[model samples]
Target chain A: MDLLEYQGKQLFARHGVPVPRGGYAATVDEAVDVADGLGYPVVVKAQVQIGGRGKAGGIKIAQDRDECRAHAEAILGMDIRGLTVRELWIEEASDIASEYYASFVFDRAAKATLAMLSTKGGMDIEAVAEEDPSAIARLHIDPLLGFQDYHARRLCFEAGVDADVVRPVSALLAKLYEAYVAEEAMLVEVNPLIIKQDRSVAALDAKVTLDDNALFRHPENAELRNPSAEDPQEQMAKERGLTYVKLDGDIGILGNGAGLVMSTLDVVAQAGGRPANFLDAGGGSKAEAITSAVEVILSDPKVKAVLFNIFGGITRCDEVARGLITAFEQIKPQVPFVVRLDGTNDQEGRQLLADANLPNVHTAATMDEAASKVVEVARA
Target chain B: MSILVDKDTRLCVSGITGREGTFHTLNNKRYGTNVVAGVTPGKEGQDVDGIPVYNTFRKAVDEHGANTAMIFVPPRFAADSILEAADAGIKLIVAITEGIPAHDELRVYTHLKRLGDVRLVGPNCPGILSPGKANVGIIPAAFFKEGNVGVVSRSGTLTYQIGNELAQRGFGNSSIVGIGGDPVPGSSFIDIIELFENDPQTELIVMSGEIGGSAEEEAAEYIAANVSKPVVGYIAGFTAPPGKTMGHAGAIVSGSQGTAAAKAEALESKGVRVGRTPTQVADIAVEILGG
Candidate 1:
C-alpha cells in the first residue's frame, strides 16, 4: 500500500526522523486555517499518491491567507496523473541549502534489503539512474545484523555526502531503517532530503510503501490503507477473502490460482474479449467462497458473460459446481456462463453442471475453448 | 536422472498430522515416493498410512534416515520448519505452504544461502515431480510422463496447462519444478536451469515465467552465457495492468518493467524459442526434440 506524502511524513515523525512541521487539511477552509497558523510563507502540497505533482501545478506556495486559499482551492480538486487530490499538507517554507537522496528498497533478486544513497536529489531517481548510474551508491544490509550506525556512515561516505551533515544524515538513516523494519514497509524513500541554511538535515519528502501481506501483524499500518484508491469491486472481493482485480471488460472471469487466472485473462484478450475482472477463489476453495465469487462477478452490471475455468488439484470441482448451482438459485444471474472443469473429480462436477442445464450455461473442455465460448456469447 | 527428487528420496513430512499434510503425504505415497517418516512436534507415536511419525525433525532424520523434507506447516511457523529440517541435514526441502510473511521468507533465504548445501524449493509452490519415479507436492501426476523435456515454472495450474499439453503431444518431462511465485522464491529460474543443464536425461528446458521481478531477465542472461541445452520460454500476464498484484505477490508489473513482453524479448534475444501460448510453447519444444 502506498502512503500519501503527509501520511508518510506522519510515520517518519513517530520514528524520530525529522520532518518539516506540517498540518493536513481536507477542505479549502481548513487549508487556509493551517496556512495562516504556519505563518506567511508556506508550501501547500497536494496529497495524492502520484509523483510530478509540482510539474502538474498541484503544488504551490502561498505568501498570505488569500494565496493559500486560492492555491488550496486549485489543488484540492485537481487531477494529477489520474488521481484526484483529496487532501493537502501545508507547511512552512524552508531556506534552500543543498539536496540529497536516500532510500531503502528490497532487492528481490538478492533477497536482501538494499540501501541507496545519492548526492543528487530533487530529481527523478530513474532519470538519475539512467543518466549517471555511478552517482548512486548502493549497499545491501544483512537483515539479521540489521541497520547499524557504521552501515549508514559507510553509505554517506560512499555517496560523497557532504562532510558537515554526514553524522546527522547517518542518524536519520538509522531511524528510517528502524521504521522500515518495524512498519514492515516495502520501501521508504526521501527524495531531496534537504540541508537547511543552518546545515541541519531533514526529510523534505517521503514515499513509504508498506507490505500488504505483513499488514496482519501491524494494526496501525493496516489502518493506513487508503480506501479511496481501491476499486469498489476489488475491495468487496478482498473483504470476501477472494483475490480480485477489476479490469475493463464485459466478461467476468473466475479461476482457482493466480497464475491460471492471469492466463485466463490473457486467453480472453487473445480471443478478442476484454475481461471484466480477475478473480481467484484460492486453493481448495470452498463452495461458499465460489458462491461469493459469483455474486461479486455479477455485481458488475457490465458483465454480459461469466467464465469458470477451474483446474482442480486440491480444489474440488464438485464444490465449485455446487457453488454455481447455489448462486443460480440465490443471485439469479442474468448473464450466460461458460464453465470448464478439469483435474480431480472433474467427471462428477461436469456431470452435475450438465444435469442442471441452467439457462444460458455452456461447457468447454479446454482453456482456449472456454475463452472463445465466453467471448462469443458476450459478443452475441 | 532427475535433478531434485527421485526414486532414492527418503521423505519426512513436517506438520504431517494436519489435514493437508496427511492428504498429500498419502497422495505422494500413492505415486511411489518413499515416505519414510512424519514430523509434528508431539505427535510421535502416530503414523499416516504406515509412515512413522516423530516428535522432532532430528528424530525423523536420525531414526528413519530421511533425506528430503516436505513442509505442510502453517505460514507463521513455516520458516522455523525449514530451519529445523535444514539443521537436521535434509538435502532438499520442499515447502508447500503459502502466505508465509516476507520477513520470515527473507530470514530463511539468508540462513539457507549461508548453509550452501540445502535446496529449499517453495513456500508457495507445487513441489517437484520426477515422472514415474517420485512425486512430491500437489501437482496432478497424470498430466506428466517420462521424457527428455525439463520444465520449471512459477505457476501451478498454468504449469499443468503446458505439462498436459506436452504430454498430449507425446512429449514427456524429465522433471517439472515449481519455483513458486513469491517475490523471493527459495530457488530461482537460474538455479533450476543449471540443474536441468547438468542432468543427462534433460535434452531441453522449458521455463514458464510471469510478470514480476527481474528473475526471468536474469535467467535469460544466465542461459545466454552458461546453458548449452535448447531452451523454450513462455510468460503469462500480457493482459495484466500495472501495479495490480495478479494473485501472486511477485506477479505484479512494476511501473514499466517486468512486463511479459520484456521478459519474452529478453529470452528471445538469448536464442530461446519464446512461446506466446502454452500450446504454442509445447509445439516449440516438440519441434526441437521430435523426429
Candidate 2:
C-alpha cells in the first residue's frame, strides 16, 4: 500500500502542506509539456514506490526542456527495485537552505502513534540513525487526542526548526496527521521537508503507506491498489481471499492460522529450509480454501516442496486432509509434500491421508520431523 | 476459579440476530456457557435459541445481570457495541469481530481506559472462558479441560493448539483468552497478565504471542516486576523476516522493536520460560509445575 512520491505529494497538497509546483507525466511529450509549463531549472523524479531512486539515477535536475525530456526518457522505463518507471513528476526546483525529516507511523514499542522528526533530512535517514541516533526526535501520540498543535510545535522546536518556520511546519504536521488518520495510513513521511532561504518550509519528498484492512471504508483508496505491483502468486492468493506473502525461497508453507503458520515457518527455517511463501487458509480449512491455497503455492515455480502444517482447533484436521486430497486430485502437485496434522480429529485426518497412499506425500509425527522431511525432499 | 468466565459466570451475546452472532451463541450455549441473554438493536423481546434478546446491553444487563458480553457485531458497529457494553456496566466485554477501523478501536480503547474498572478483551478476538465448563467464541469445544494452567494468546487457532498441547501433556487450562490480532485492540497483554497473576486457580501460565506490537515486551516487563506464577512463553513469527506484515491486520513490524527475537529476548531476560514449539511450551509448563 505504499504510494509513489508523486501520489504522496498530491495527498500532502490536499492537506495544505506546500510542495514545489509539480505535474506528473506518463510520456516524453507530456514530460516536455510539463517542463515547459514549469519553466527552466526543473527537477524530474521517477514515480516508483521504492526508495534509493536518487542513487539509482531515477531523479535528475534539468535546466532546459531538452534535458527534461532526456531525463524523463531515461527514467520512464528505468528499473529501480524491480519497479519500472511508468511516470515522472516534473516540478520547479526549490532553493534549499536546510533539510529536515519527519514521519508519522505506528510505534509497536509504545503501542502509540509515533512521530519521528530529525534536523537531518535529505540524506539516508537510516545512515543518520546508525551514525548519530540522537539527532532524531521521536514523540508518541495518544490516538484519542491525536497529534495536537502543541505536540507538533514541540516536535518542530526539538527538531531545531527556526521560529520563522515552526508555525507553518507545526500546522503542516497537524494536517499530515489528519490526512494519515483519515486515509487509515500506516505511515506518512515527508523526507527532506526543505526550508527555503525565505524561511518557508515545504515538503520536497513524500512517502505514504496505507492500511489495507481499512480500505473497505475508503473505496477510492482501495481502487488505487495496483494488483500489478504485487507478486503474481500473492495477487492470485488475494483474489481467492487467502492471506499470502511471497518470500524468496523454495519451501511452500500452508497453515490455518497466522500464528501457527508463522511458527511453522520458523520451524521450517530452523530445520534448514527456506520458506517460499506465507499462506494462511484461515479459520475455515474447508476443501475449497485448502485447494485454493495449494493451487496458489503450486503456481510459484520456485517452490521446491510443499509443507502442510495444521494445528487444528476450530479447523478440523479431517477437513484439511479432505482438502489436501481433493487438491491433489486437481493440481497433481509436482513437488514433494510434507504434512504435520495435529489436534482435532488428527488421527482420523492421518488415517484418511494414509488411505489415499499418495506418492510424494510424507506424514511426520512432529513439526520438526515434518520440516526436516520437507527440507530433505526439497534438497533432493 | 478461572481467570475470566467459569461455569457460574453469566454471559450475554451481543448482535445475536446476525448470522455469525447466532452461530457462536448457539455454540456457546450448547457448550455449557450460561448465556442468559442476547442484545440486538430493534430485535428486542425475541428469543434466540430460547435466550432472551434485548435491544441494548443495558437492558440485557439489567434483566439478566449478565457480567460478561461476547460481541459479534460487524466491524463498522463494533466500536459502538463495545461502548454500549462498557456503559451498561458489563464487567467484561469480548469482541470477536474483525476488520474494525483502527480509529474506532482507539476510541473504544480510550473510552474503556477512562471507565477504569471494566475489562475489554478484544474487538477482533475469540472470547475467553474456563475450559470444560463455560466455552466462548469460536474455539473448538472439545480441546479444553479444567486444569491449573491459564492460556492467553493473540490468535484463536494458536490458543486451541496450545490448549491441546497442554492437555496432551496432562496439564489442562484454568482459562484461555484469544485476544485477537488487531493493532488498537480494546484489551492488551498487560490486562490479561494481571488477571492470570492474581487468579489463584492458575498455577502456571502459557502466553502465546505473535510479532507486531510491544505488548509482549510490556507483558515481559510486567512479569519481571510482578507475577510470581510460572510463565511459559511461546512467541510466533520468530523466523519471519523483519518488516513483513503478518496475516493479522494489527501484525506489522517495520522497525527494530516488533521482531519476535526482541520479544523472546525480553521475556527470557525476565526469567520467564520461553518455548520454541508447542510441545516445548507444554514441557516447560509441566516442568515448572512439577506435573
Candidate 3:
C-alpha cells in the first residue's frame, strides 16, 4: 500500500527522522489555519497517491494566508494524473542549501535490501539513472547484519554526497531504515533530502510503500488506505476473501488459482473477447467462496457472459459446481456461462452441471474450448 | 535420472498433522513417494497414514534417515520450518505453504544460502513430481506419466494444465517443479533448468513463467550458455495490467520491467520456442521431442 506524502512524513517523524512540520487539511479554511500556525511560506501539497503532482500543478507555495487559501482552493479539487486531490498537506517550507536523494528497497537481483543514495535530487530518479548511471550509488545491506553506521557512511561517500551533509544524512538513513523494517515496508524513498543553511538534513518528500502481506503486524497502517482508489468489485471481493481485479470487458472469469485465472483471461482475449474481471477463488475454495465470486461477477452489469475455468489441485471441482448451482439459484443471472471443470473430482462436478441443464449454460473440455465458447456466446 | 526426486528419495513431511499437510501427505504416498517420516511439534508419538511423526526434523532425519522434506506448515511458522529442515541436513526442501511474509522469506533465503547444500523449491508452490516414481507436493499425480520432458514453472495450475496437455499428447515428464508464486522464490528457473540440463533422462525442457521478476529472462540466458536440451517456453500475464498483483504477491509488473512480452523476447533470443498458448507450447515440445 502506497502512503500519502503526509503519512510518509508522519511515519518518518515517528522513526526519529526530522521532517518539515506539516499538517493535513481537507478544506481551504483548515489549510489557511494550518499555514498561519506554520508561520507563512508554507507548501501546499496535494494528497494523492499518484506521482508527478508538482508538474501537474498539484503543489504550490504560499507566503501568506491569502495565497495559501488560493492554492488550497485550487489544488484540493484538481485532478492530477486521474486522481483527484481530496486533501492538502500544509507544511513549513525549508530553506535548502542543497538537495540529495536516498532510498531503501528490496533488490530482487541482489536478494538484499539496497540503500541507494545520489547527489542529484528534486528530479526523477529514472532520468538520473538513464542519463548518468554513475551518479547514483547503490549499496546492498545484508538483511541479517542490517544497516550499520559504516554502511551509511560508505553510501554517502560512494554517492559523492557533500561533506557537510554526510553526517546528518547518514544518521537520517539509519532512522529511515529502522522505520522501514518496523513497518514492513517494501520501499522507503526520500526523493529530496534537503540540507538547510543550518547544516541539518531533513526529508523533504517521502514515497513509502508498505508490504500489504505484512499488514497483520502493523494495524495502524490500515487507516492510511484510500478505499476510493480501489475498484468497488475488488473491494467487495476482498471483503469476501476472493482475489479479484476489475477489467474493461464483458466476460466474467472465475478460476481456482492466480496463474490459471490469468491464463484463462489470455485465452478469452485470444478468442477475441475481452475479460470483464479477473477473479481467483484461490486454492481449497469451497462452495461458499464460489457463490460469493459468482455474485460479484454478476454485480457488474457489463458482464454478458461468465466463464468458469477451474483446474482443481487442492480445490475440489464438486464444491465449485455446487457453488455455481447455488449462485445461479440466488442471483438468477441473465448472462451466459461456459464452464470447464478438471482435476480432483472433476467428473462428479461436470456431471452435476450437465444434469442441471440450465439455460445459457455450456460446457467445454479444454481451456481453448471454454474461451471460444464464452466469446461466441458473449458476441451473440 | 530425475533432478530433485526419484525412486530413491527418502521424503519427510513437515507439518504433517495439519489439514493441508495430511491431505497432500496421503496424496504423495498414494503416488508412490517413499514418505518415511512426518514432523509436527508435540505429535511425535502419532503416525499420519502409517508414516511415523516426530517433534523435530532432527529426529526425522536421524531416526528414519530422511533426506528430503516437503513443508505443509502455515505462513507464520513456515520460515522456521525451512530452517529446521536445513539444520537437519535435508538435501532438498519443497515448501507448499503460501503467504509467507517477504521479510521472513528474505531471512529464510539468506539462512539457506549459508547452508549451500540444500535446494528449496516453493513456499507458495505445488511442489515437485517425478512421474511414475515419486511425487512430493500438491500437484495431482494423475496428469503425469513417466517420460523424458523436464518441466519447471512459476505457476501451479498453469503448470498442471500444460503438463496435462503434454501428457495427453504422449509427452510425459521426467520431473516437474513449481518454483512458487512469490517475489523471492526459494528456487529459480535457472536452478531447475540446470538440474534438467544435467539429468540424462530429460530430453526436452518446458519452462512456464509469469510476470513479476526477471527469473525467466535470467533462465533464458542460462539456457543459451549452459543447456543443450530443446527448450520450449510459455509466459502468462500478457493480458494483465501493470502494478496489479495477479493473485501472487510476486506476480506484479512494475514500470516497464517483468512483462511477459519482454520475457518471451529474451527467451526467443536464446533460441527457445516461445508459445502463446499452453496447447501451442505442448505442440512445440512434441515437435522437438517427437512424442
Error of 1 at A201 (Å): 1.5
lDDT for each residue of candidate 1 in A84-184, tens digit (9 for 90 to 100) = 77889999898869889999997787789999999899999999999999999889998888998889989999999999889999998998998898887
lDDT of 1 by residue, B29-142 (tens): 999999999999988898887998998999998898899999999887888999999999997999988888777788899999999999999879999999999998989897
Clashing pairs in 2: none
Q: Considering DockQ, where higher is better, how would the candidates rank from best to worst?
A: 3, 1, 2
| lDDT by residue (tens digit), candidate 3, A1-380 | 78888899999999998899989899999999989998989999998888788999998999898999899999988988778778889999899988899999977767889899998988999899999999999888888899999999999999998887788999999999999888888899998999899999999999998887778778899767663276778888888888899989999999988888988999899999999999989888999999999999998889999999998877999999999999988888898999999888999999998888777899999999999999999999
Ten contiguous residues minimizing lDDT sum, candidate 2 chain B:
B249-258
Compared with the true structure, the alpha-carbon lDDT of candidate 3 equals 0.90
Q: Candidates ranked by TM-score, best first?
A: 3, 1, 2
Count of backbone clashes for each model? Answer: 0, 0, 0
Clashing pairs in 3: none
**Residue A116 lDDT (model 1):** 91
DockQ of each: 0.67, 0.63, 0.73
Per-candidate TM-scores read 0.95, 0.94, 0.97
Docking class of 3: medium
Task: Output the TM-score of candidate 1.
Answer: 0.95
- Cα error of candidate 2 at position B170, Å: 0.8
Q: What is the TM-score of chain A alone in each candidate?
A: 0.96, 0.92, 0.96
* Per-residue alpha-carbon lDDT of candidate 2 for residues B103-171, written as tens digits (9 for 90 to 100): 677667767887898888876777887877788788777777788998889987777777877887888
Task: List iRMS (one decimal) for every candidate.
Answer: 1.1, 1.8, 1.0
